[model samples]
Target: DRGPVPVEEGQEVDVTVDSVGRRGDGIARFNNFVIFVPGTNAGDKVKVRITSVRNNFATGEVVKGE
Candidate 1:
């Protein structure tokens, strides 16, 4: 069984974009959980605010880049 998701809606976290999704969103992993962040690219280190969280993945918006 899976543990609880590492992020929640409205939470801000730092992440490094590991890859790009098919639609071009940046993909980051937090504690092995997937987070899709828009307006970012692969190799980018960014601060993102969690917008939505699902069972398997989460979505976030870029707050800033590092």
Candidate 2:
């Protein structure tokens, strides 16, 4: 069972990196929802564009320093 996805494709949002996942991606939250972003680390703040959205989580790319 899953809830409605809070984000849509190409949506840009800002989040604070909370931790690193097993694949070395930075994990952050939007409204307590999880998003994984590569090339980021814990304590890093960034803006991301949503690339994919799944049932429980989403994937995004860092668009910072742009």
Regions of model 2 farther than 4 Å from truth = none
- Please report how far candidate 2 places residue 45 from its true position, in Å: 0.5
Which tens-of-lDDT digit does each residue in 1-66 have in candidate 2? 546788988999999989999999999999878999999999999999999988889999999923
How many residue pairs of model 1 clash at the backbone?
0
Q: Please, what is the TM-score per model?
A: 0.95, 0.91
lDDT of 1 by residue, 6-58 (tens): 89999999999999999989999888999999888899999989999999999
Q: Which stretch of 10 consecutive residues in model 1 shows the poorest summed lDDT?
A: 1-10
How does residue 7 of candidate 2 score in lDDT? 92
| lDDT top scorer | 1
In terms of lDDT, model 1 sits at: 0.93
lDDT of each: 0.93, 0.91
Model 2 TM-score? 0.91
Candidate 1 all-Cα RMSD: 0.7
Candidate 1 ranges beyond 4 A from true positions: none
